[model samples]
Target chain A: MTDRPLDPAVLTPDQARALFRAGLSVPTAGWCAGRTQANLIAVPREHAYDFLLFAQRNPKPCPVLDVTEPGAVSTRVFAGDLRTDLPAYVVYEHGEPVAEVADATEYWRDDLVAFLIGCSFTFENALLGAGVPVRHIEQGRNVPMYRTSRPCRRAGAIGGPLVVSMRPIPAEQVADAVRVTARYPSVHGAPVHVGDPSELGIADLDAPDFGDPVDVRLGEVPVFWACGVTPQAAVMASRPKFAIGHAPGHMAITDARDCDYIVP
Target chain B: MTDRPLDPAVLTPDQARALFRAGLSVPTAGWCAGRTQANLIAVPREHAYDFLLFAQRNPKPCPVLDVTEPGAVSTRVFAGDLRTDLPAYVVYEHGEPVAEVADATEYWRDDLVAFLIGCSFTFENALLGAGVPVRHIEQGRNVPMYRTSRPCRRAGAIGGPLVVSMRPIPAEQVADAVRVTARYPSVHGAPVHVGDPSELGIADLDAPDFGDPVDVRLGEVPVFWACGVTPQAAVMASRPKFAIGHAPGHMAITDARDCDYIVP
Candidate 1:
């Protein structure tokens, strides 16, 4: 497969799902603009109860949009099979990643239950529209995510530190960004922390635990929002016997509109 | 046990829970007025996924505050044990009510998961404070609830007609009641239907599926809000081998304040 991504900017949800179904693996950052995209997580039916409980306890980091019946193919959020609808899938066995596949057909199992969790794409659009500049978007890079010291409420075997994505904003627009994103609770809600990275036990802004590091210019303060990856981190920490997730950036596109999810 | 309910107006949470725990199996209405009250539903671990899914699918009718760890006695919402803290419990075997007991300690099992679902009591206070008189309160009777033709979003085995509580709102103040109660989404949010009872397939305002019927006076309209009892109705419809629920009007009081759950 070529390294080039098909221009997903103009594709509709149906078209995008079809494209991904054909085994294209690419970041979904700019695809289906104005629509809600989701981070996908799949776990065995036995472990699903714990994962759902974990999401409920830590809603900000794991806003559950839709959950599928065990081994069920389609979800209400997206009318596509979980196994073949994603651009890329990361298979984890006993909490360790074994392969990154375009289609998870080979890894699919009867007891696997898939979950569509809210992603930050919706809020990020709100931020951009509100004129709150996202530094990573400006640099055309993945958002810098950090492993925060703040621990999420534990549920059964799944428990870990809250992971957050940092976006540097002009000090003046910090309140606007918070207010804009706060309207969409299903999509990571509001900034979990602002100003000091040290408060979250994050040492240097240039060094992130995941994703590419973006520079924080003078007069700009770093703002952190709960990331959807927190659930993945929990799954890894717990060392689940079997797990499946969308490769970072290769998210599942949903038919839901971003405006519909806005809480008043 | 006596038929008389304690004068709950002055009792604290701890005192109220203790009263109920000591075998005072009376209706919890008007007791623990300031704190939040919840409808209790307990199901075996094997069927917990469906119950949780049912709540997520029909959040308006089942605003879940907390779910206990399977076979765990206490919950985050209320510190009291699920087995013996409640004054009234309706035990079900294969979906049929087998008995109503003051204490369910004998039926307790390591596999039972109790759910704390939000009730409309919090919003009722808001409605009264907003000067929207609740007719049932005026009549000193239980709120009138009906089984509506409207069906809830089904999840797995749980599917049933929505059950709603009707409050007679003066024609002039129906909108005000909605606005006031709309502020609390954790409760039933806003009115699902206003004015005509026939629209919801409710045959008569005087006949309710549950609770005592309150009269709809000449200039007043029947307002329907999704009731927490809808989940219980669903549970009964699914007919799991074992289930436990609080008898109607007997609720569990929690430490949370009504103001804290206000979305805005």
Candidate 2:
């Protein structure tokens, strides 16, 4: 752990997946520095349309990168198999997580459809490139997230509150942060709210709904962007009979460049 | 008739829709100046998933703006009814046009799902705003379009060749045309091809497959853009048992402003 760089200069995307496949269930953050990582969700074919529509309707929360064909384990960008490539997966049944597994091969079903959603890692890289300090990365912690009062636009059987990830930026640097992230819409583009925590029904900055809270320094404002974990919230609220997702902070690394998602 | 401004400075979106609803069958191109106009496609809900997937897969050819809920005639942005809003519709039965109707109410089924796709008219506005001459508009004719050799990525049962609309631009203004239209990805972004007809397998510039040809003056280059009408090609090739689409050049005008589609 001491030898590993906080941000690796460069690494092969396959190397990360290979380690995960060999049962090294470590968090994939800080590895494969310039590549795109993604959140994974697998639902039955019956609910696939609704999930796709849900992501389309609320793109800020669920900017989809690739959707695997129904019952198929292959994806467009990643050579890794969806069923067992990730380090960990959380299985959900009727809205509750039933188990966390290193590989979901045993739980795989022919009726399942998988989706790879854009992870905030891409935009965080953009922000970092612009010299904006991501407090979580600086402090070596997960980005703090909160469930907002704003309801996501509904799609068929899927709808829930929007979840947002927060990063504190120096007052003068907030605009630059927004401008940089805005370029990457496929990876949770632009901030949803800036300045107020209560507006999102968030209270007590130190206590976040998910992830460890990084300290907000004086002269800094907490900025919120729609989170990639939102689909998990939607899955929970909708209480689909069966679902599978990568455990939070444990994501699937793909063979895509982070800069490929930049719009302008 | 002489008093009516063909380019009405201020026509309410509803007024034009009312005309279409009241048995007035006419092209909508010049009627709504500042609003977003879209191409319409309706298919049975049974095949809607495949169609939606196909559009997502081939976005340059089919940039979907809004999709109606299954069995519903209303859309999110368009004020007019899908069944009667557009002045005319071409009903397709197993891939070929069976009838051109003033209204599709009689053809509408409970299982029908409608999608509104971005029309190139939006980017044409951007180009015109940037002082890039559009030869077809100046000549008062349809923009020339051709089916290209490039095949659209298949989704489910839908797959076909890419269809592109062409506009001849003064060679000197070609960069400005590209720069302006690049802002509007929803309306097929920048030109797919810039100088050569042979590159796209088009035998002659004067012989367009779909629309009336306009003159390409000397020192001008033909610019090709991904056409919204490509979905009709896919619908025809896939030969779904039933489908409905707007007649070529007849579009559904929506309440959204055209500039709203600008990506930057």
Candidate 3:
């Protein structure tokens, strides 16, 4: 309720979520240090099966961390209310953006099934911990993402192309980046493509489809990891009756630690 | 098909499936040595959302490898027909077993959705490669499975207690078994319990609820891994209108290699 800015890094996940619930709208790039963040997507129960199948088929691009039962307001990993906990939400009607709102209670439905998917932001900390430079975080810009030539396997009524986020890492540390991120399989594990953007049908590295593009630098290689934007892309392509998702970079922070997902 | 008994160890997955498709019914143990095997469960589309939610909530006991679309007969990892490829099937009506048959074609419904859950059988080969002794395979008996006291997180209409398969490992080799099996998360991951059976609310380890009992040596420790029987146990407890599952010990062999699921 005060007029001063809050420091995201030092706040607890509950504190950060409380601020968002109180109508503070901002991208959650860095919040609650080690807690995991998630991409949100809520759809009608009628379309839940198709969406679940879509995620099961396309795991790299859509690693599902948690799923809520119909009309449920919370999941196992997230304790806050789904209707008002996230900083922002995009309401979609027949796959078209109908409204962007801070609170989604007015548009929430009793039969909605919300899915909490793994976000790349969860692995960025691990990357930095391993001494791999993340260009976007260093430049204070959003990560660059692109729509690829790869088409995700269609499930029932859902389908779309794979979307990838780009991070320019030094050529010498690219393998280290892969090793670090591969440990967290639930969060966009490992880079899908390295070295060439043309192989993924991405042109003009400076012009990204979503988010701000960062410098590739002289000796850095463009490393691409599957992005969380994939399900939204699928929502647009499939044209479902109704859908809801977290606004770009405005994620739902969960209580799970980054190490919880790390595998052997 | 000839009446002569065939050696299963050297056969390809497709060859093994062909034998099953031609009415050869037997447990898939040791068949197609290096290939992955799965537990099959098919349910009506009306109940799929609940089932998918159940698997998501209880991942250890129900590690989903592949899920087929409603009315579809195959999955990405499974190329054979769901109706006739598997060796044997148990058809259920209102959760009660109505019939056991060689082919499920007559009981197959267009609205059915099939799920390929990861079985402990897939990890047994890796355990052997790591020098961990497998008593069940050595004794030519099935792995002993029991119902634990811990209840699984309930999803809509599905709820049940956790089911686990027990394996006896030498005290020195228990760590190696855990390390080796931990690499394959898709195959029920690591051990849920290491030593005490009484802690899990089981009175006697020798009297198992499913599969045959195996001996535990003087210096060996009993290790428990989440079993694939958990989902079927849920179905039987919840009593859905219709369900189909693979007969005990009979499994569906997949084309995926054991190394494909290994993590760093």
Candidate 4:
């Protein structure tokens, strides 16, 4: 067996699929550098409308890239085979994580529809290239995420509190951060709240509901952007009978480039 | 009773509602200048997901501005009471136009949801302001719309051929027409096709599927953009038990400005 790390530059979207098919890479984030990667979530067809409506209501946190037809695995917008393209998958039953697997071919059902949602990694690269520091990346830690007091707009059976990711920015560089990220609205565009964590019901800076807590020094303010995890939280709260999503950091990489999502 | 024509410039979104409430303006198009005017459609709650998915599938034609809570009359994003704010509404039953009512108050149900979609009039004004002559406006007729051979991708039970509106532009001005309209993606951004009508299965310029046909003069090519009427066509073809939409030329004016829809 070849033990070399997968080179994203050398792989095609199809080759990436082959790698995932072989159980090579477990997390899909750093695998395909320039291509768009999506956060995948599959739910039973009975709850498809409710999940879709939930995504629409909370667009900032869940900008839907494409939703596949019921019982169909291929999506027209995001090119890739949903069954084997992703390197990892997480199956949830009654909102609780049951298993982590490489391929969902066995768990897949005829009544399941997949949803591809925009991921912040696409825009984060843009920010880094533009000289904006992504603190979590610099510290080699997962971005801190918190459950906010602010509730997402309810739609049918889907309703829950908003989940936000926090990044500390120097006072002088705050505007630059906003300008860089604002261009990609499809990936949780612009910061929802800039200054106060207290306003979001996050009392202690060190304690986060998910991910690692980063340092916020003297001159930095805790800037918050809606996180992709909001939908997962909503799904968990709604407690749908069956759902599947990417394991925390793993995602489905698409043929689309990050620049394609930029507005103007 | 005062018989003065409604002056959009002087009215607030609430005042406009009061005026519409008092039966002062039957057609909402010219009443609220500068504010975003929307295409209103109400569907039974059971059919809400299909219609919403249809809108998502055909966004250029059905650019959704906001969707109201189920059974709720007021829109959280657009503003005011949907029941009496609109000057007029057309009720359709079993795919046929049943009544043109001044108010949907009586027909309003606890299981219905209102959807506000982007209207092309928002961008038409910008085009005219930029010196692009709109043919139908000059001739005092409705803008010409045609049914195309191109089919929209299906979602749930909604699927049908695309419908587009044609505006004749001088060959030299096509680029300017594109740049100006492309700024407003929410309101059918950019042209779907240009130059040849026959390519879209349009046989004669004189006959159109909906609205009046306009003349295309020498050195001008008919530019086509997805029309807001596409959803209505799908609804009719699908034959939902009941549906409601604004009468053509009549729209729902909102608190949002035309510039608000522009991404740049």
Q: What TM-score does chain A of model 2 get?
A: 0.94
Supply DockQ values for each candidate. Answer: 0.44, 0.47, 0.77, 0.41
Candidate 3 chain B lDDT trough over 10 residues, lowest sum: B1-10
| Candidate 1 docking classification | acceptable
TM-score of chain A of each: 0.94, 0.94, 0.95, 0.88
Per-residue CA lDDT of model 3 for B1-264, tens digit only, reads 334246787888888888899998877777788888898999998999888878888888888889987889898898889898888899999889899998999999999999999888888888988899989888878788898999999988989889898999999999999999998887888899999998998889999987788999899999999988888888788999999998766888998887778786
TM-score of candidate 3 against the unseen true structure: 0.96
What are the clashing pairs of model 1? none
* Tens-digit per-residue lDDT, A77-160, candidate 2: 788888787878999998899999998999989999888988887877778878999898888787788888899999899888
Candidate with top DockQ is 3
Candidate 4 residues lying further than 4 Å off, grouped into runs, are A1-6, A78-84, A105-107, A135-143, A166-173, A203-208, A212-222, B1-6, B15-30, B78-84, B104-110, B128-142, B168-173, B203-208, B212-221
Shift in Å, residue B127, candidate 2? 1.2
User: Against the true structure, what is every candidate's RMSD?
Assistant: 2.3, 2.2, 1.9, 3.5
Residue-wise C-alpha lDDT for candidate 2, range B143-243, written one tens digit per residue: 77888888999988888889898998999999998888877776788788898988899998888877788999999999999988888988888899999
Q: For model 4, what is the alpha-carbon lDDT of residue A221?
A: 81
- Candidate 2 global lDDT: 0.83
Writing each residue's lDDT as its tens digit, candidate 4 over B1-264 gives 235354565676777777777775444434556677788888898888788888877777888888888887777656688877777777888778788776788878888888898877788778888899888867756677788888887767777788888999999999999989988888888899998999999988789887688889999989999887777777767778888887655677788888887764
Instruction: List model 3 lDDT by residue over A146-167, tens digit each.
Output: 8888999898899999989999
* Model 1 CA deviation exceeding 4 Å by range: A1-10, B1-10
TM-score of chain B of each: 0.94, 0.94, 0.95, 0.86
Colliding pairs, model 2: none
